[model samples]
Target: MALSDIACRNAHKSDKAKDGKAFKLFDDKGLFLLVKPTESGWGKWWRFKYRFDGKEKQLSLGTYPEVSLGQAREKRDEARKLVAAMIDPGENRKAVKEARADSFANSFEVIAREWGSKKVQTWDEKNNRSKRMLERNIFPWLGAKPIADILPKDILASLRRIEERGTIETAHRTLQICGQVFRYAVATGRVDRDITQDLKGALPPAKGEHFAAITEPKEAAELLRAIDSYQGSLPALCALKLAPLVFVRPGELRAMQWQDVNLETAEWRYLVTKTNVQHIVPLSRQALAILLELQPLTGHGRYVFPSERTPSGIRCMSENTLNAALKRLGYGKDKMTVHGFRAMARTILDEVLGVRPDFIEHQLAHAVRDPNGRAYNRTAHLPERHKMMQQWADYLDALKQGAQVIQFPRQA
Candidate 1:
């Protein structure tokens, strides 16, 4: 028999518990709340179960009196509307809650992994170094914490720890990396804003220390003379000789490949230089001679300075290789480093050789100006530069042999 509201109200709970079977009552024509008995010392439990979209779903509207028969019917109608639209109300509710949890649970390490895989494609060598330092120092300290929960105080504390070790530069670098990570978090919608912005000027400034080098001309002459007598391989000897003539950064010189050099044309093309511009170094006669001698040994390899022991070719010469070679001739970092060759050339070529500062700066791959008062590729002076390079090398050679100094062109 179909139940009525009067019958549902009259249906009282028996003293003993009933199992499996439920007391069913209808508040309307097709809607019902089934009250089932449990042996767990509770009065009874009610579930509003109905069919929607050819599927059955139950909405637990609470025990009888707590959720009246009328209220259960209303809840059932709302759930039916969700099902009519092909939506599972129960599952949809759970999904919303889970998404909220995931956003709150996002940590620095988790976001960094995503950034490394998806976001770091355009990052250059310098950016990679910054990222590496962050992974090594900052990540281990605060990576697991939720990005949202990280405060300015927490960041300052982390930097304070790094500063305690007396690496002021490292602290600054770590903060920069941290700032980038926070910005990445913002870009991905993980954080609302970067807390690292407040951290600017918060940490102690790094000491202004120039890269160690030897700037004296006579000392550089001795160093060049010693390099000429180096018992190393021909490529190493040639790189050392060209290091002064070209005055390119050591990494740039070591990374040079045969494809970049044009021996017949007396030019070396740098496609990707430190300034992120194409650079062309016009080779001097002395530089060409060095290349001619090196061609037989490392000409077939990919790198101009290939490691003698490896068939796969050198990825890069060791950073310490040039410094160690200098050490062999009783010179330390201060006396004459590989990089000092640039300073020596820039100093002498300007003061002694009377080469225009602008020309010397351009030849040294430093930023310089054009006739239009705008920055231009200094390689435009290649013809004049070629002559200047040969003259510079000849002058250095004369100084090494204790010959009388030749008059240089007056500076414009």
Candidate 2:
């Protein structure tokens, strides 16, 4: 006979002293409430006794009142059904527990970090930049969410927050990386699909403002004169002078090492940090003079532009060093940025000098392809680039001397 709820609530514990002994109140379908003796707090537990594969087993339904008698009966019937199908309910519960553990182990952050660790090897400084962006933007909001459970709205909300800070480009890039992570998750079977696909055209278009550059010959000449007269630190003076000649990114300039320079060949070769391509910067007579002048000060250390105040000199110049120098020289960020040097050279070299676009692109380390769809290797137009670099340096000198502007015919 099944036990009644009235009988369960009024049940009494046995006074007999026994170790781990309990009095059983049997219910239907092998369900029973075990009332422990008074020494054991008279606790009650629901148990289901069954057989599977000709073997007897007992499954604990749960404690009484917490799991009501009605609930215990439901669980007993379900386990009996499993036993009829020759399955062990205890093993099934263990499998479900393991599955849940696997899901949490493959959570979004865990998978993203695993993917990031593999990706950062190819990315140089971008590794740190990506880590910072994730920690600041993505991780706080969605890092703990299960990858399989994250909806498109969750991703869009995070990206929209980034855009709120006026870094739309960063938002776009973060979305791109998120898509990569999602695709990786899909490939690994952690998630069913990459919902980032659903977010196409979701963000506002990136509003890109070109770096402030002085394209006009006369204005560039004035800027050059101002830079030449800058009486800042020797590293700053050298970086400013070399900025126009090399036109590398500011970070690249700050991280320049001494070993990559070859004064005899008049060339400075280093991996372009942005593109991860080996780039060769032809050192003009003017550029070489500036490097040689600073060689005495920073040559002993690892960096060609080592920080003066740093004791170990392990770190190079600060990223803001040139921009700060420009500020002091009255070239506001709106008037000129350290990055504007690349634009300055790109505009002047093509508009003023008769250098071919291909030669200029090669020197700039930009990835370009011919009509044959073959990507031009970094060393593709080395000889022509060398000549073009020298002509560009001479043109800057002519401009600084207040020479008359000469316009080149546009290439067809």
Candidate 3:
């Protein structure tokens, strides 16, 4: 006879004084609910009993009430199907668990971390942009799955999550990063092909937005002179003083930390967010003096330009702060941008100063390559760049004093 729901509810109720002895009520086939007496009432565990590999084995379906009689019967019938095929259901469960654990060991997240750790070492400034992207967008969704098991759809799903967040540009970068990982996986023999290759043109294209810049030296000199005479907060003043000197991306400039600077060495080192590369900016004498002057004021906080708000002082200034200060100095977004500092330096360094284009690109944290087509490590050409930075700073000072523009012969 089949076990009824009422029988399950009252199971072990009749055996309270059995001194912790357990009993079982069998349903049709090999399914039964083992009722164990507890302090409050009873613990009903549904179990399926069977024999396989010339030995008896039992598998727990689930607990009663939660599992219910109907559900327990369904589970038992599925397990019976496995046994009928001469398979061991108990061993099958263990095999499935072991497979999952193996997949985790060979997971995309694990491989990505391995590749990033090695790649970040080659990249100076220890900028782990790949690691940051994996953690933020990819890991949460696709981290644990086996790298071999991840299909193009899985990659697309993760990329879409980033796209839906309105970070379409970041979504594209994330896809590029994924492609790198897949290539690594291919090289390592983990996968036969790069799955991200199948995702070409899957995402909508991201439009480029270029910041306005004053490329002419005479115009830049006027802007530099204005920055010098502008009245502003000490941080803003120091920022204005050093902006044209270093010409780092405004976000990198604003988020500059005290710990990454070495006044003795005249260097400002940090990870550039856009390229995810560690960048070293050789500070000019003028730039160092401005820094040393601002030290006594903002040296106490995490950021060199700490936010004015209480408790938020750990963070850097708001994005609009520098542009607002620029606006106050009469150079609106259409005329000049904080990012334009990079463009100004790029144009002048190559066209006017005759600095090596490679050095200029490296200083700007762009992807620079050697004649052999390999990226120069972080410390490449440091001494020469150090000299060039000082010269650039001196040139700016001369411009501020209304000196004539001196042009150097272009590199052939």
Candidate 4:
């Protein structure tokens, strides 16, 4: 007998059925309500059974009450029409669900997040800047779109918006990072190829530029003297003083952890986030002295330069702390920057101090490879780098005293 509205609404498990047992109420043409006993009363689902290709199959219409008797019948009729045409409605529904799942899995944002998560240990975006970049720039545009569905024009449109905001360099970097994500998607079989490959030269080329620094002895002397008198928080003061001594990247300096420093060995060993390589910086006596002074203040904290402004005291010095301190010392962004310390050290060491370029490059944590094309071990030239570091510190002291330092020709 076909199910009626009154029967459907008042449906219950068989009175003689044991606890947890289930029973079905048949309507006709393979449609039925499978009602299972529940703790409260009964649970039910609307089911449609049929045969396709000489095999029996079942499909779920929905649950009771939510899917009423009339609604279930309407769905049963539609599904019957599909079965009459020799289509297996069950298989058709499965295919539709699988396609939706595949599209969501292959979405650009999903793939990009997966790629970024794999790079968390090595990524230089210490503050989740890379994730924010996607959320702000790329995700808003192509995030939900499947990787294969995204054309080169879609990417260009996103990048052009970044460029229009006058962050031409950021737009270029965003493109590069996106290309990494697309290639990751391709490798994972989500897409057959990286669509970003076709976007070569689609955006403006990045400008060739370098950070500003006082490389000349006289100007550097003036800047060093200015830093000596520029007062700030203890963390900022120590970072500004030590910036020129070790000359590591600004991020590397600020993120310096207490555990990474070995005062006994006069070395600061840590992973280079950008290159994902271990780097050892031989600490000069001057550098060691600055650290020793700060030790009594911040040695107990997680970061050597804990941000004074934060309540947690867990985070390192802010990104702008050193640059802002430099500004207070009369060094504008065009005149000098915190990152300019690396350039200052590289230039002065190779040109004025006549240091070996390899040693300077290695100390700068740059890639210095062997003739065989393999990168030199991070500990490469440890002995020589130690001597060079001490000598460089001594030379800087001489320059601070306004001594005349001779500039030698750079090596070929």
The best candidate by lDDT is 4
**Predictions: Cα RMSD each:** 12.7, 8.6, 5.9, 5.3
Number of the candidate with higher TM-score, 2 or 4: 4
For residues 79-162, could you state the per-residue lDDT of candidate 1 as single tens digits?
778777888767876898897667546988777666665655323332245566767777787877888888998888889988
Clashing pairs in 4: none
Model 3 lDDT per residue over 1-412, tens place: 8999998887766654267688778898899888877788778899999988788889999898999899999999999999999888888999999988888778999889877767654222222456678889999989988999999999899999999999888899899999988898889888999989899999999886679899998898899888888787888888878888898888788789999999998998888777777889999989989999999889987778876553445667656778888999899999999988889989998999999888888888888888899998777888888988998999999988899998998654
Q: Candidate 3, after superposition: displacement of residue 154 in Å?
A: 7.2
Model 2, range 142-250, lDDT digits (tens) per residue? 8888898899999999998998898999998888889879998988889888899999899998886568877788899999999999999898899999999988888
* Regions more than 4 Å wrong, model 4: 1-101, 122-126, 307-310, 369-374, 404-412
TM-score of each: 0.64, 0.68, 0.67, 0.74
lDDT-based ranking, best first? 4, 3, 2, 1
The global C-alpha lDDT for each of the candidates, from Candidate 1 onward, is 0.73, 0.83, 0.85, 0.86
How far out, in Å, is residue 224 in model 4?
A: 1.5
Weakest 10 consecutive residues of candidate 1 by summed lDDT? 121-130
Q: Identify the candidate with maximal TM-score.
A: 4
Tens digits of per-residue lDDT, candidate 4, 201-295, equal: 88788895568888887898889888888878877888998999999989889889989999999999999978888999999999999999999
- Of the candidates numbered 2 and 4, which has the greater lDDT value? 4
Considering lDDT, which of the candidate structures 2 and 3 is the better prediction for this target? 3
Off by over 4 Å in 1: 1-132, 142-158, 174-196, 271-273, 307-311, 370-373, 406-409
